[model samples]
Target: MKQPNILFIMTDQLRWDCLGYAGHPDVKTPYLDTLASRGVVFERAYSACPSCIAARAALHTGMEQAHHGRVGYEDNIPWKYAHTLAGELSAAGYYTQCVGKMHVHPLRNYLGFHNVELHDGYLHSARYSDIPYQESQFVADDYFYWLKQELGTAADVTETGLDCNSYLSRPWIREERFHPTNWVTDRSIDFLRRRDPGRPFFLMASYLRPHPPFDAPSHYFDMYRSMTLRPPFVGDWESTEELKRYGRIFDSRTGPADPELIRQAQIGYYACITHLDHQIGRLIMALIEHKLYDNTVILFTSDHGEELCDHHMFRKSRPYEGSCHIPLFLCAGKEALETFCPSSSCRGLIELRDIMPTLLEIAGADIPDSVDGTSFLPLVYNPQGTPRTWLHGEHSYAEHSNHWIVTQTDKYIWYTQTGKEQYFRLDEDPHELCDEIHNPVYQERICLLRNHLIDCLKNRPEGFVEKGRLSAGKSYPPTLSNA
Candidate 1:
């Protein structure tokens, strides 16, 4: 009974419905499609705090946002978790390594992996003028440092004049082989070629694409540029005035005003996804060539999702389905698949925190006492098993900050700044085109979900709940006082 190797694959800002296996009509992700077909896909997976730092905090620590203390998208906060996914597996005699996107403070914090080949993908905080030379992305990020050496210091990912967070896009200015997505795969394949063969290994191959600067190779961009694609879904609650207010700004949370810009963004985003998918296929082939395919367990997911102009929103940190819902699946060898993943898909609700305990259980390692998440390994074999009754999610995003509760079939959102509420019956409106907040038919269910959120926030330091009710306009911080 030898322990199986683990391949944790993560993509940044990837929407839940962007893959062919997810029934997306426009995107081409044949490798990911095949993986989902053979594995168990969690049809209702979500990121509780749908931002990079908060989501990764949950993923690595197996703790919810409140427990882990990151509720928003702030950067430069130190990561101080005692027990991490990689740390636990390393303690259990597995050699652990992460190849890309640690995204932690001081630019090189390894959390618990034995080694990390870092590339956090064009962070403004890391490249600030006041930062020391040694800690800057130019010197600290492995991939960026290599790029400078190969093409001189003047060469940069921003050479195409696109902001990292902007919806504007173009093809990569350099060779396709030098792209960050390809670099992650290249380094991961190299690791497989020279890993410690006697012991099981835990490898996290994280990619930063389909996020922004939407610069895939030209060939991939051309694949979708000419095809007719679906337009963004507009909700009944969205205001035309709000769209016009922020639409003209680059890197706006509300998307662009021009329909042509939105269409081009979609073309660039889908191209980046297909480019990422092919890179994943290369890793899969490397596994087979090394005869490690049968002994590996591969889990694929994203930190959060891009809004892609859904409901007129462009970026993440929203409570809507496009920003919070994420794709999650597990593919494994024959024996593990037969014993654990007996079904092709499960309807159970899952969050980023659950990844730690599930992978630790698969590795025969100890689930640390600090973890607040439950392993969903049981649900793979028994799809009816409940991982959780509901999930409470929130993010601190200035005036648009929100709190939400979601079950498998419905959702409730409360805007902290304005006390605005929105409800949606997801089983019927999967795209969330209609807001049922004022509808009489769902008032009872909405009240129940609201109470769930109140209970979740009652003990928090921010005083979100007061005298058995939710209070609006409370001051919010990205990290809790305890953190």
Candidate 2:
């Protein structure tokens, strides 16, 4: 096939199992489920840093968080990479355009995209007096600006009184057409109409919904309002005290004050997911109408997963499945995956860094050596093929700073600041309800995984490890701190 157009769809804070194809019993994601049926699913995909900036850093640069120089989730840091997925694709004659959420520094830096219709939704760091909403720094924010334009200056998330990170459930403040999700889908379809027909295009439709504010349109919210959503998974070893202690606050690590509020939050979250799914269906229809569907490779994934009151956690940046695991699937029109094996699944450990190289390989472009990720294209035909034996990931979050090593069937985790260890047999316990670190029966397995973690951090500039073993009490930087 000639160079195919790439439609890369990404979402913020979306759980891996939130789709119908991923065993989500409550949320309705028919469009995504159809796409998954026509493509390949990476069952073990993960976000290395599991935060906005650092996750995107690994995504754009095709490098691990540590190699990308943002092991944590620091913002305002310039994306000064010598090589980027969009940049390389553009260099190889593909026209790259991002319609939403670049989440990079300087707010408008394209990195490699020829044009970016920016809409990074409700960034607390950029919404305050330090970077006033109307300042030039925030002027190009398409979503925020458009919201005020349609609903007047008084229009803000505060109008609904929904905190950006809170689990509170509510319909959008205005009409569904004015929502950010619709805006992104509308602009993406517009791009399909306006893009240069002579060039194969790489379009990124990044949605910020399903992240927080739990503000889905009324129709979407109503879909789940009457249904019983799946309760969050809580392990025997987990504690809800953290959430109870820090409840009734916005963006707090711990969530709503009680079980009732927590349920309300889940209702909102499920509504957002379904709302986003409908918008994606619109985008798919647009592609079909334009006759671009068959020749395009549609890659659907997310930056990271949301905790959503799971194990008493609300947001991301943890090493748990709800925080680190993400959905990854690719689809193409008109039996395009025949050569790549249609309706397949791979159990390899995939990460955000692998996305760039995978798309590059799909586009028939040369993969750069500077990329720490290896393309998994071979796995399309051979399901057992894997790029690596295991994936090593870490994140910084005050006392929660932690590192983890995971393969297809098992995982080993360590809290960098506390030197605490955890082991889980994913094959036996997919929800991670049991921590087997203290189990004497798995001592040998623990040793192997511990060594893997040690080797992963042995060369770190942060001295996380010395003489091939981690030492406790290291001061890891916070996500938003300048690295």
Candidate 3:
């Protein structure tokens, strides 16, 4: 039997619940919904570190944040992993290529793919004044180079006056084909037409939309701008004073207090998602047209998730479900499904790390000893099987830095800087509207999860654990010594 081709479609900062198949009332994702129906959806998927750099590290290395040495959202840290997903596949006789964001240091690090058409979106670090000209985003990104060629050198993604990390939004000012989302699909389809026909290929179509600048085409933006969407979930633990403190700042992490601003942000976000979904539909069509659909295995997921004003938070790096929880689903032809995932859905816990081993297993490649992630193919065959009892997640975000333990049905969070803690019974409160940390009835479960985190952090360099208890107020850096 011929080895199956792999299409790994990744989106940035997309929330798990924003898809129509995931029961999102406002967002219309017909293509993604159709994709989910044809495969297994891992309902409990999450990004352990809940930040771009750390989460992508787990995805590429098949290792947890600790093993990968990136625990937070730091940029320019050299990716020095020995074994990577693309590397293993490439070694297994597959031609690997990545078309979009890799988020690695040096801006052009291939991370083991045979070739990369790099575009990491608007990275602030890459645009720094002192950075070398060759290392800058404009100099290294293929999409930007193409954009400038098509519309002169002065043309940039920042023309709409929106900050990349801000909640502010507007429709794309250029032609629809010029959008980054469209460019990724355009390049992917082009790849399909010119790939090595004799060998199976591994193509990672990584997109950078729905992350921010929230600039989808006008039709997509208009799709949800007039609808009555769901309001952001406000937890009982949130302080109104805190919300007001950072409300006026355009790029505030806590988001704005104005309901209209939040509503506009949601409209723009949903628009970007729908636009991305349509681009995915184009890729799917291209696969069918090229007669490669039946011989390919497709996996769709996001690195982490957007908070989108949930609990008054607008960005990621939080332990909240809005930040850590992500969408994960895999689909394939009839034969591939029978051979790999023979189920409709999986209820087992999953993280970004699991992506590497799972794809390597499906491709008939040997998973490296350096990988700490479980394949999760077993869980797809047996949906009720538990690959892991729980997951330990953390991020180093200054005062809001936190460590968390999450299972399929609940989560325990510990704020390292302030010694504050929060516990949520996810099965009962899916939106996390209530905090049960101090509740006497659930103290035993909380204690158990806390002990698990302690075990995970016991040997850490930051001294997060001391004498069987969690140590707070210790300064933590984003990258470990290995990085």
Candidate 4:
């Protein structure tokens, strides 16, 4: 069997329901919609940790959050994994190259990518001054250096004047070509032209857009600026007080104070997705132009999701579907599509960690026994195949930490600090509007899920469990950084 090229595309902080194929009312993602029609879409994919670094850790290492040693958003964590997706692919004779954000510690650390054109957008920890030469963002981030070269040394994200983590929206201050989204695609196309043609390639085109700063190019922003965007899901079970939990700028934990601001942010976010979709289309065209389209397996997904004001939450690091659920689609090449199913949707729960083994399977590379994720490649022909029964998700940030057990039909959640329980029937209430934990009808259901959660946490390294029970009020701080 011949090895097929793998084109893995990832976006940061994009929601699962933001695409037109997801039945989104207004977000126009024609390219993605078309791609979905030609691919198998994983309807229930999720990110276990629901934060950039931890989620990427699971993605890169094929290990769950607990196994990867990061349960929350921690920066500068040196990825010391001996076995990585890229490493294995490279070992298997694939030329591995990453064109965008890796989010790994010692920011420039390529893990096992033969080369990385790194660009993690506006990370404060990496940009902080007094950084050592080995860890300096100025020297590490290829995009930052390129931006300086194009816009002069004085150029910075501040030129846009939008808060990096805020709900504020704006058009890109520079030319659209200089946008990070465009840069990733441009660099990826360059790689296609310059790669070793004899060897099968594993190219990761990772875009940092649709994440935050809500900055899209003017034309793309115009596409949604006047359009009526989808409103955030304000669940009846969610406390209104959560809207006021944090201020209105820079890492706002809660939703916006003004409802109009929410609309603006959604417009910007949707625009970013569309902008990203256009770039994806360009890259696909480039693949065809380079004669690599029919023989390459293209996978599109995200590291995690952004709340976009869902349940009065604005960002990731939560157990809610808005933050944890992610988009996943795989389109095998023309020749490979004969064995793979297309225009299909699978309900089996898939996680970010699954990407590693799935790609390894496609490349005929060895799937390490240490990997916690199982390949869904078998499901291409057997869509009805039974997958993992459930997925355990958790994240710790601010004053709260959450642990959750999600199955196909329902999700049960527990707040470790507050010991609050919430349950939602995903089959009926996909938006999670009603929490049925207090409903007597779900007592047995809730108990089953809680026990599952307890079982998952029992042997956790963080010791969130004690004697087969979750230790309430336990504080698990971020300790997985390179420091």
lDDT, model 3: 0.92
Candidate 3: where are CA atoms >4 Å away? 339-343
TM-score of each: 0.99, 0.96, 0.98, 0.97
Task: Tell me the spans in candidate 2 whose CA falls farther than 4 Å from its real position.
Answer: 132-138, 335-338, 478-483
Residue 145 of candidate 3: its Cα lDDT?
Answer: 90
TM-score of predicted structure 3 = 0.98
Task: List lDDT for all candidates, in order.
Answer: 0.91, 0.86, 0.92, 0.87
Show pairs that collide, candidate 1: none
Tell me the lDDT of candidate 1.
0.91
Report the C-alpha displacement of residue 89, candidate 2, in angstroms. 0.7
Q: Is candidate 1 or candidate 2 better by lDDT?
A: 1
Residue pairs of candidate 2 with colliding backbone atoms: 73-479
Rank by lDDT, descending?
3, 1, 4, 2
- How do the residues 1-483 of candidate 4 rate in per-residue lDDT, one tens digit apiece? 589999999999998999999998898899889988988889999998998888988998999877788888777667788889999999999999999888888787888999999988888887777778767777789988998988889877767877767788899988888888999999999999999999999999999989888889889878877776667887778677656756455468886878888888888888899999999999999999999998999999998889888887888888888899999999877865457888898988899999999999888889997699999988777777757989999888856689999999999998888888899999999989999999999999889999999888886666778876778787677554321
lDDT of 2 at 397: 82
What are the per-model C-alpha RMSD values against the true structure?
A: 1.0, 1.9, 1.0, 1.5
- Steric overlap count per candidate: 0, 1, 0, 2
Model 1 per-residue lDDT tens digits across residues 214-266? 99999999999889999999978778776799899988888899999999999
Error of 1 at 169 (Å): 0.9
